[model samples]
Target: MSYMEENLEKYADPEMYDHLHEGYEVDLKTILKWAKQDGPIVELACGTGRLTIPMAQKGFRMIKMDIK
Candidate 1:
């Protein structure tokens, strides 16, 4: 089986993942601080776009990717 097939259970519930990750902003400040505002940022394994959406709102061009 492929990687995604094997990991189906892990990525099955997006809502659960979001709930678990909600209010977790430990990395946001650092990421914004280091990342250039005028940017085309590529975020691999960007599950549920938690960071991608915020960055895009801040005017960053986001290329988000995930298997599911």
Candidate 2:
């Protein structure tokens, strides 16, 4: 398998992955501060967007890009 696919397969259990990664989620308050700004936010190699989605939820304009 490709490297990315291999790693994804390792984390196939969503509940386990979510539980492990959830702590890395972006703090809503921090995101809100950046969202208050007018500049666009870009997360290169954004993984699974654990941070990106939350920032987006707070009305932040975030562009998430990941490459395998």
Candidate 3:
């Protein structure tokens, strides 16, 4: 496997990744605004649904994908 594939589990740990990215999701309003204007969104490496959930909650259609 590639190095990134081997390390996929680490990135897939929702709790661990969320904790590590504690204040990293600062684009809530920005994403919401854009999604409101634009159409659906596709988020790559959407770890833990951190921003995805909120965006969906705000009525945006999002497709979240990840290595896991």
Candidate 4:
């Protein structure tokens, strides 16, 4: 397995991983605006649902998946 796959759980747990991002915010708005589509969205590496959760709350259909 790849190093990331081996350590996937460490990154997958929100409680364990969320603290790693403490204050960082991903700018999904610009990406959304640029895409010009509300989705059905396909999100890769959707760690802790950071962007995915909000977009889903906004009513976009999200397919969230991650290898880690």
Please list the Cα RMSD from the true structure of every candidate, rounded to 1 decimal place.
2.2, 4.0, 2.7, 3.1
Best by TM-score: 1
> What lDDT score goes with residue 32 in model 3?
62
Task: Give lDDT tens digits, candidate 2, residues 9-56.
Answer: 845665676678777645655656645548778888566677778788
lDDT of 3 by residue, 4-67 (tens): 6787756756788789878776687676655662677899878779998878887778999976
> Number of clashing residue pairs in every model?
0, 0, 0, 0
What tens digits encode model 4's per-residue C-alpha lDDT throughout 1-68?
Answer: 89867877566567868788765655786756654354488889887788888777877888899765
Q: Candidates 1 and 3: which is better by TM-score?
A: 1
Which ranges in model 4 have alpha carbons more than 4 Å from their true place?
1-13, 37-39
TM-score, prediction 1: 0.81
Candidate 2 achieves a global lDDT of 0.71
TM-score of each: 0.81, 0.55, 0.66, 0.62
What TM-score number comes out for model 2?
A: 0.55
Question: Which stretches of model 3 miss by more than 4 angstroms?
Answer: 1-12
